[model samples]
Target: MHELAIMESALDLALGQARQGGAGRVRVIRLRIGTLSGVVPEALQFAFEALAPGTLAEGAQLAIEQVPACFWCAACAREFTSADLIAQCPDCRELSGDLRTGRELELTSLEID
Candidate 1:
């Protein structure tokens, strides 16, 4: 799965940062995953478990924060959480709006020892 590659890259980045900070090992990796990011959390978790063997992040906890989709409804003149991509304004049923968030897959922080 592509999540394996993604986890590999994330692990590499976290390991690099930990090494630069003179960390002996990583304790946790905090990730922010948006609902619209198209990333499967379970797949990512399995990939991390399989790939972290013998690495600095071995046994490290992967903490994922789920971000909901937020958008601005032009017709309603308000920002609200979207149920899906085609979500219209709940009040006015208008399809036009600006997506504000929920398209991110960011590695926020790493807790290393």
Candidate 2:
């Protein structure tokens, strides 16, 4: 699964940050995941379990903040959320505009000792 690779890279980044902060161990990792990020939470969690055992984040808990896919409709002059990949503006039915948020895979923070 690509989640394995994603989590591996994220864990490596966390480990680097932890080490930079002089952390002996990591307790938690806070992630901001968006609907459009194409990541499955269960799979990512499973990947974390498999990859964390031999690192500073061995016993860390992964805290995920799920963000909805949101978009701004210029035609309608409004913002909306959609579970669909192709979102039509509710009012104007336009399929174009600046995507306000979502599409995120950000590692927000890490709790360490």
Candidate 3:
């Protein structure tokens, strides 16, 4: 799965950060993975576990924060979450503006030892 590659990149970043911070080991890797980011939670977790060995992230807990696919309605100037690709504004039932918070694949924080 592509999650393997993504997890590898995340591991690289975590390792770099851990080294920069002079951490002996990584305790946790917190991530914000939006729904529209196209990365499955379970797959990503498995990837992390598989790739974590022999590195600073060994035995580290992976915290994946699944972010929702959000939409913004310009007519009502409101923001809302959606489960479907075709979503309308909850307040005005109108089409929304560009998706503001979805499609996020970022490392929000890390806990190091």
Looking at model 2, residue 61 earns an lDDT score of: 100
The C-alpha RMSD of each candidate to the native structure, in angstroms, is 1.2, 1.3, 1.1
Question: For candidate 2, what is the lDDT?
Answer: 0.91
Pairs clashing in candidate 1? none
lDDT of 1 at 95: 81
lDDT of 3 at 6: 98
**What lDDT would each prediction earn against the true structure?**
0.88, 0.91, 0.91
Return whichever of 1 and 3 wins on lDDT: 3
Q: Lowest lDDT 10-mer window, candidate 1?
A: 88-97
Where does model 1 exceed 4 Å of error? Answer: none
Query: For model 3, how does the per-residue alpha-carbon lDDT over 22-59 read when each residue is reduced to its tens digit?
Result: 99999999999999888999999999989999998999
Which is the leading candidate under TM-score? 3
Summarize candidate 2's per-residue lDDT along 1-113 as a digit string, tens digits.
98999999999999999999999999999998998899998999999999999899998999988999898887777889988777898888889546777889989999999
Select the stronger candidate by lDDT from 1 and 2.
Answer: 2
